[model samples]
Target: MVFEKIVEILRNYKEEPELEVTMTSSFEELELDSLDTVELVMEIEEAFDTSIEMDGTLLTIGDVVGLIEKAIA
Candidate 1:
């Protein structure tokens, strides 16, 4: 459920109808800049009703899913 939500958010934020977003897809692969990442984090937090602390380790969609799980757990 979380992964799907994240994918939706990514798609909406990226506005790339053809972009294939998956768990293994990295922010680099998505061409998201640091500001874009920060904005995405904000959107994720709002969607999940939780907070996430950004770090260097959050590189992929799976990494963010893990973070959201940990945050809400």
Candidate 2:
């Protein structure tokens, strides 16, 4: 369920017409900068009804999914 929501959020932000995303994809691979990460974190917080501390760590889609799973659980 969290994976699906993350995918939906990411899909909405695709700048190109044919960008493909996957679980192992990194934020750098997705072209997400600091500002984009800020926004994505906010959306994730709202979706999970929990808080996330950046600590300058999150790198991959899998990382975010893991955090979300922890928060939701």
Best by TM-score: 1
lDDT of 2 by residue, 1-73 (tens): 8887888777776645456767798888888988898888788778778986775788888888888889779
Candidate 1 C-alpha error for residue 36, in Å = 0.6
Candidate 1: RMSD over Cα atoms? 1.0
For candidate 2, what's the RMSD? 1.8
lDDT of 1 at 57: 86
lDDT of 2 at 58: 86
Stretches of candidate 1 above 4 Å error? none
lDDT digits (tens) for residues 1-73 of candidate 1: 8998999999899887667988899899999988889999899999999998898888999999999999888
Question: Which portions of model 2 show Cα errors greater than 4 Å?
Answer: 15-18
**TM-score of every prediction relative to native:** 0.92, 0.83
Measured by lDDT, the strongest candidate is: 1
* CA lDDT of every candidate: 0.91, 0.80
Model 2 lDDT, full chain set:
0.80
